[model samples]
Structures are given as structure tokens and as C-alpha cells.
Target: MAHWDPRGQVAPHVRRQVASLAAAVDELVVVSTADLDDDGAAFLGRHGRLLRRTNYGYDFFSYKTGLEASRPEDFDEVVVCNDTYVPLVGYGEVFEAMAGRPADFWGLTASQRVHPHVQSFFVAFRPWLVGSQAFRGFWGRMSPVSDRASVIAEYEVGLSRTLTDGGFRFASYYTETDADRALAQRRVAWWTLHRLPPPRRRREWEFLKARSKDPWNPAIALADVALAPSPPRPAGARLPYLKIDTLRYDPYGLGAERLLRLAERRRPEELAGVREYLAATAPLSAARPDTDLRPTPVGVRPLRRLVEYGRAA
Candidate 1:
């Protein structure tokens, strides 16, 4: 697993999730921004490997930084996730599914259910699939600079086209919203705008309201169910269906103490600096941020404590 963070401090929830993942897997690596400074460096050094870089914009920057810092050949399999999505199960089921296929790269394309949070915009795949020339061709056609969003757009379009051309079909649930959570909310909003409380006024108002807003709000599209192509493919370039619920767990924690311990063993001074920064930024803590060291308590600290941590160290 590889993690990238722009901030000096990692969120508490993210820390726990990461910890759970590391415990499940054998090799864990982290790539951070050097801008995190000594304290941030110390924390990462203790918990996992740290690779520092400058913060670029979202989309492209986050991906580029992670890609540039990753040693893909180091592990047999790798998983990528953001701070928001936590793993609720282990990799056992996923691994078994991959048994028949090559392990060059695997991406989780299915979810247990429709998530109501962020929309699941793009399908998952091995980075290389979307990183290929076919994808670049798509990107070249879409965006000139190839930043984050554009890359994502190009990846989606290109991957779909490529997979389809290769005889593989892309599948999605017709009834699902973005990440699965929006479906419910969309239905509620749609009903409120159009439904009449009284039988006397069963006018075209509700339908009209839906028509007016549906075009503008993408979530409204979830009301319609779009099923995947029926019948699994028998030959090359086929999309396979894996039951979403088969996943065992999804973690969302990062263990700070374990991380600290790792750092102390690898780089003592760096670990000290990290603890010092955390202390300095901590509310009512002895350490204070000085001219050189500015502790920024990022995770669970209070606002005043965070401000002081930033001011102290």
C-alpha cells in the first residue's frame, strides 16, 4: 500500500485505516511531501517509508506524486485509495478472484452497494492500462496540458474504448448513483420537487420539476437503472463480474504510535523531530514552535491547539 498526503499531519481516521492495511499486508510504503518538514518526516519515517515531494494541484499532482514515488515491482499486489474511502474487509476474496488472471495489476471495480457519498465517476483498472499509448492518445485529444481532471477524463474514455475494442465490456449498475449513496438522496430530492400532497392537485408539476432539474443535476440520472451487458464473455477482452459483497474488509485507520516506533528505528533524529512537532503543536504541551520548527498538529487536535501547534514547534 502507498499513501500520499499534502499536509504535515495525517488525519486520525486515515491513520487507523492505514494501520489496519499494513497489518494485513506484508510490505507498506508511504510517500509524503517534503514540505511536511522534519516533524512530518519523522512521523512517516516511523510508520512507513516516506517519499517527499512538492504539492501539485489535485487530480494530476496527487497521482503523479504517488506514481513517481512508487516502487511497483517491490510488491506482488498493490491497492490505492484516498483518505475518505475505508476498507471494510480483507483482500482474501479479491485475491481468490485474481487466481485465474495474471497479477500484473488489478483494480477494484465493484463496490458492495451504491455509496451515497462521492459519485463513483471512473472505473478501476491497473494504472498501466490507463497509462498506455491508447490512453495517451485519448488524453491528447481531450486536454492539452494533461493535468489531473483531464487525465482522469482521458483515462475513462480511453480505457472504455480500449477495453471495448479488446472485446471486454465495462459494466455499471443502472440504479446506482455516484458511489452508491447519491441514489437515495436523489430520489428524495426528485420526489419533493414533483410529488403533490393532495389528490386534487395531481398535476404535471412534479414531472415538470423533475424534467427541469434532471438535466442540471447529474445525481438525478441515478433514478434510471442501467444494467451491465448480459452474459459473461468467454474469450479474450472480457469484463468479469465479481459479487461486490465478496470483499472481506476495507480499512480506514493509521496507527501513529506504530508509525513513531518505525521512525525511531530507521531515523532517530527524524522521529524526535516528529514527536517534538506533534508536542509543540499539541495544546498545553511543553514543546513550542520556534523559528525553525513549526509544529502543525493535523489529526485530532482542537482548533486552538492546532493554531498554537502551528505557532510553536
Candidate 2:
């Protein structure tokens, strides 16, 4: 997976994720957006090929860079992902589910809100799609820009349109169905009531409820449910769905908490790594003026510690 961090170093959770991916795939290459420190370099170097580049393009550019360096001809399939979400559980199950799918490219989940396209957080491209002119031309025509909106509009949204228009079939692990969408809405409501503080809870509930009727992007809510600790379920819910878009909205750091829990349960040895990471990064996150001002929740002690550290700093 192509990885990027604004801090110019990979987080411990990301390192663990890379190790997991390396175990599943035959070849793994990490294209970092910035120069790695000795530790980052050493960690990534041991697992796979590491390509460091100037932080010019976002994940899209990082993907392109990794593709060019690896030469798509050398591999049958290429998976492009970032360090945005923690694959708490079922990392291998996701790939295993997609193994025999007959699609040019596919992602873990598809979104239809902004446009009909697979969310780029975790996408896999087969050789047929990778070798196509549409894929090559998309990157060839790409111009580096630091603007987030431009990247989303031109690359994230536009790339899907380009490939689909070029007759490349698209598929996803989970397609939004009416039943699941309703489940997602209910999940959002339950989370708002149980998770958020009383003062902010009402406002968030009303806003989410209204949006649930005609969600601009249901994937966000779907992800909230899929990654939630104990997701509420109807009578019989069997299918597993996954989406990992961490950058969009995670004001409470619940994403990190879930990831920490996953590590503690499945991979307890990694807890120290995740704890150290949160202790260091959470303070940086809280220090921003735009950060949520609400007090940290009761159970997320690591985040609370970080808040204290930030206050002292």
C-alpha cells in the first residue's frame, strides 16, 4: 500500500499494518510522501521495497509513484491503500473475498453520494485495468497540487469516471443496498445517542437524521457502523463490510480507540506500539485550534493522556 504521513514518519500502527499486508501479499512496496527517519526506513525496509519521495501529490500521487517504481507488469494485481484506517480485524478475509472476483478493479466499498465510484481508501487493480490506456492516461495527465478539494474532484472522483467510461468494470466488497443503508442510518442514530455527550449529541443526531434520509455519502455512516466497537445489528446480520477512511471525520479519536482495542484483542504485543503512537500524535491532534473542544471520553485513557500532555506542552 502507498503510505503518506504529514509528519514525515510512519506511525506504529501503520508499521504493524504494513507487516500484516506483507504477510498476505507476495510483494509489498511502500511509497512514502516524505523522507523516512532511520527507524521508519528500517521498519519499512525490512518488510518491503521503500520509495521515499517529496510530498508533492497526496495518496494518488503516492500510488502512481509506487506503481511506476514497481512496474505494474511485474505483478498480477496491485493494491493501493493509505494509513488512514486501521484494519482492526479480518485484514486477510477482505482480500480472500475478492480473490476470484471478475472485475478490472475493485475496492472494499463503493460510494454513490458525490459520484458513483469506489472510495479510494482501499482499492485493488487487476492487470487488465492497470495496463489499460485509461489508467495510464489518468496518471500521465495528472498534475501535482496540494489542494485537497482539487485532488478529490479531479483524481478521486474523476479517476473512477475515466476508467468506467473506458469500459473497465468496477466492483466493491460491499455495495450499498436499501436494507444496508437503513441499517447504516440506524447505526448512526444509535452511535449519536450512546457515544456523543448530551450537549453535542442532540445537534449531531438531528443533523445525521436529516442527512440519513438523503445521505450525501452513506459510506461515512456505513464506515462508522463497520468500525464501531459493538455495532448494533438487526435480527440477522451476517455479511461483513469494511471501509477505512480515517481522515474525513474522527473528532473524538474513536477510530484510534477501536484500533487499540483490536490490537489488544488480536495482537496484544502491538498495544505498546499503538499506545506510544497515540501518546505522541494525539497531543499534536488536540493542539490544533480547529480540534474538537469537548473533553475526552472516559474509556479512551490514552487519548486523555495525550490531551494532558498537550495541555502541559
Candidate 3:
């Protein structure tokens, strides 16, 4: 299952991602937040089912709708993912690896910032989990929410706790480690001091501290580790923070380009639809200018320096 917002016309990149996922799964169901444009509808028609709905509750609602449309007994496993990521490397291999793992539910990554939960971006639930009363109950408890923070708190964080309390087990492709926590903390400091602005920095810093005891942000850390070279290390290994402000800053298309090259070399057929998309959406500039880098505020500078030293060491 994939949740999308056509926005206007669905980008070629999104279509390509959907097509890639379609190739990997037995059935592909797309729940769109808005009606698809003709091109979007036509492209998805070739790949899978596309259902349009009001953009009310965000991905969680779309996820519920998709689950409602499918019967648990009909499929051995079901995956729910959103279109924020492009599978650059072994999309198949990741699933194959998870298939051998014995867990009721699993995702490509996990976060332990506030509470441990499998990041919902690409999670797979076995039929056992899918059919569980707990599973159904979780969705049943959902209320319509358009706020990102509310979704994160009530759904993303709440889901893991709900399921675990119900005696359902979970796992992640990337496990949490002490090293990961240590590195994450350092990165958090770096991001707060160097990346954010004066007015917002303190607030973001406090939020980061409250949500994560560690230094690094989980989402940013996940991207860093997942996109690393072969023999990938755990999240927050050596991967630098990649600012994820959509088009405002990206890593010069390094991750996507790497994936494209890998696809061209090994899965040429899979590269067809994405070629035009990648060409059209290539990053228009180099990395965002770093002229804004500044020292932390007087009260915070010493603490920031301590973290910077720890990261360096």
C-alpha cells in the first residue's frame, strides 16, 4: 500500500517509485489524498489500484482505508509505504531479508527518540499481525488529524506502544545500538548549532532534546545510514546529516543518482520509467550555501562545543 497526494499532476518520480514497488509486490494499492490527474491515473492504471479520497487525515487515514479495502486472509504479507523515498539499491533484497526474520511487524528502520517504533515509511505486517484484534483496534482508535505533530504523537509513536502492549512483537531492519545513540546526540548538537536559525534554534533544540535523549534526529539518521555504501552500517554510524527540506536542500542527488546508477547496471528494465523523472527533477543547484553557519548562542556554545568534540573524537 502507498499513500500519495497528487498535489496537482503526480510527478514522474512518484510514478516511478509506485511502479518500482508494484514490481516487488503481489498487489499494489494506492490511496491518494486527492484525485489523480489524467497522467497520474493512467500511469497507476497500468500498475495497480488507485483510490481517491478527501485529504483529511494524512497517511494514517490512507493506511486505514487501504487496509480496510484488503482482506487479511487473502495475502501472506502486506506492506505500507509512502512516496517520500526512492529505493536506490536493493529494494527486493530488503524485503527478502525481512521475510526470513520472525516478527509480527517490521519496518526498514526503527526510532527510539521518544519511544521505540518502527518507522512507518515502509513497514510490513504478516497475516498474523494483520488479523490481530490489536491491529484492527489501533486503526479503530484513530481520529481525523491534519497536523503532522499530532500524527507523529498519536499514530507513529502510539502504534508501537499499542501493539507491544497487545503482545505483538516488532523488529526493524536497522537495530538501535549504543554507538547509534552516541552519534545521534552529537549530530543533534551539530544540527542545532549549525543548521538552524536564531529564533527557531532554541525551540528546535528543546524539542530535539525532549523527543530524543540521543543527539541525532532519527529520520535524518535513517537517510544517512540507508544511503551509505555497500555493507551498510547501523543508523548514525558515519553518515553526515542530509538536510531534508525538500528542494531547498538535498545532497546534490547523490543518493538518488547512486540508486539510478545501480538500477542501470543491474536492473536496466526497472530504470525505464524513472529516467525521464530523474532527468527532469535533478537538483537545480549544488548543496545549499553554508554562509549561514554560526556559533551557538552564549549560553549554549559550551555545550555545543562539548558535543562537537565528542563527535570528532
Candidate 4:
């Protein structure tokens, strides 16, 4: 898994997540951009090889680095995922389901908004497709750039286009429905009507109660779906993983309360991990920061040493 943490330490939820996922794969490789501390590195090292790289091209480069070091061609299937979501169930079931499907590549979910493509957050590629020239050529051209938009456009979405043109097919595990669209749009609209800024935690949820629940923000509803899963309405809907984007960014109005409800109802096994993740990310306020800009370093001196990584990202 491609991993990053500002604290240079693994979160409790991620530790549990990695441990559970370890059983589903023959090998586990964690590529981290963060300069992990000794305990963090040792914990991850226990599972499999742990690599540290510069945070250059975001998660895709981390995926690239891991694949290069691990010899992906030797494996029957290779999965590229980031720590962007927390799987509520064990990956054994997810792998079991994907193995029965008939696609060269498959992901957790796909989106139709920006051409027909699988969201690249979590994708598994079959060996046949992985060995093809199209697969190699795509990665061969990857370059390190800080701008995320270009990475998504050229690599994330580009990979699907390249593979598809080469006669390889791709699929998604969680296919969204018209009902999901209605629900996602409604979710966006609810937050839009309330006009909530970036949310930090459940304490700010008081605004949700005080705000309108009309779900009729036409402009936002018409905006492209943010490629996130909607919250469970009936409360037991099948979402294989709870997207961290939904909770941390709240782009889809899928917050802690809905997730807690789902976990409390059916998947209590993951309740503790889910709670820790939520509390860690949940901010005390949605208020914007007053001083985000930082002053440049003096003389560009770091003890006469320079560390540059991901130059080929």
C-alpha cells in the first residue's frame, strides 16, 4: 500500500488495516513518503519491506516505486492502493470477489463523470495485463511533477485509456447505481445548502442540525460527482470500504455519524478502528487557517547535505 502520514507515524486504524490485509496477499509492500520514525518503520517492516521515498508525484509514484522494487511481473496479480480509505471488512472477501470477476484489471469502484474509468485509489491488475507492453509503456513514461491535476490526468486516468486501447479490459468492484447518484447528489446538496466549509469533527455537526436538509442545491447537484460513495441510508448498504475522503473532506456529506451507525449495526468488528480514524482526523472547527504561508528557508543549508528522491517519479 502507498502510505503517507504528516506525523511520520502510522495511525492506529492503519496499523489494524495493514495487519488484516496482510493475510489476503502473498506479499505486502508499504511505500511511504513520510520519514517514518523507528517504531513506525519497525512495525511496518514486520509485515514486509518498507520503503521511504520523497513525496513527489503523490501516491502514484509511491505505487511506482513499490512495483519497481518488488518485481510485479513475478506475481499473478498486483494491487496498487493508497491509505486513502479504511476497509471495513477484511480484504479476504474483497480479493475473493475480484478473483471470480472476468476483467484484466478491477478497482473498488468506477466513475462515469470523467469518461468511463475506474477510480485509481484501489486497483488490481491481472498478470496477463501486467506483462503486456501497454502496462510497461505507461509506467515507463511516468515523470515526477508536484501538480496533482497533471498526475491524475496523465497517469490515473491515462492508465485505463492506455490499457483499454491495448485490448485489455478493466472493472470495478463497487458499481454505483442511479439510486447512488440520487443519494450522492443529495448528500452534496445537503452540505451545499448548509454551505459547510471543510469539516474537522462531529462537534461542528451542530450546524447540520440547525441548517436546512432540503437537498435541492441545483448547481452543486449538477457539478461532477466527487467520485466518493454515498452514506448508507437504510444503514446496511454495501460499501466495501469507507473512503477517507468522505470523512476527512466530507465532500459527499458522508460523516462519522452515518459510518458509526453502520458499524454499530452490523460491522462492530471494525468499530474501534473506525472510531480512532474518525477522532484523529476530525477537526475541532471548520474555520480556515489564518497563517498557512511559510517563510522560505535561510541560505538553503541543511548541514551541507541535500536529499532528493522521486526525480524519476
The prediction achieving the highest lDDT against the true structure is 4
- Candidate 1 weakest ten by summed lDDT: 244-253
TM-score of 1: 0.42
Task: Give the Å shift of residue 226 in candidate 2.
Answer: 3.1
Listed in order, each prediction's TM-score against the native is: 0.42, 0.70, 0.71, 0.71
Question: Candidate 3 lDDT, tens digit per residue, 46-83?
Answer: 88888777878878888888888877558988888776
Runs in model 4 deviating more than 4 A are 185-237, 253-268, 271-313
lDDT by residue (21-131, candidate 4, tens digit) is 687899999999987999999999998789889878989899889989988988989999887766764687777777878899988776654456667878899998889
User: Model 3 segments beyond 4 Å from truth?
Assistant: 176-181, 192-216, 233-313
Tens digit per residue, CA lDDT, model 1, 5-84: 43456644345555655665555556553256566566656666656555443333433445446654355444444433
Model 4: lDDT equals: 0.64
Per-model C-alpha RMSD: 15.9, 8.0, 7.1, 13.9
- For model 2, the run of ten residues with the poorest summed lDDT: 304-313
Model 2 accuracy (lDDT, Cα) = 0.63
Q: Could you give the candidate ranking by TM-score, starting with the highest?
A: 4, 3, 2, 1
- The pairs that clash in candidate 4 are 143-313, 144-313, 200-282, 200-283
Q: What TM-score quantifies how close candidate 3 is to the native fold?
A: 0.71
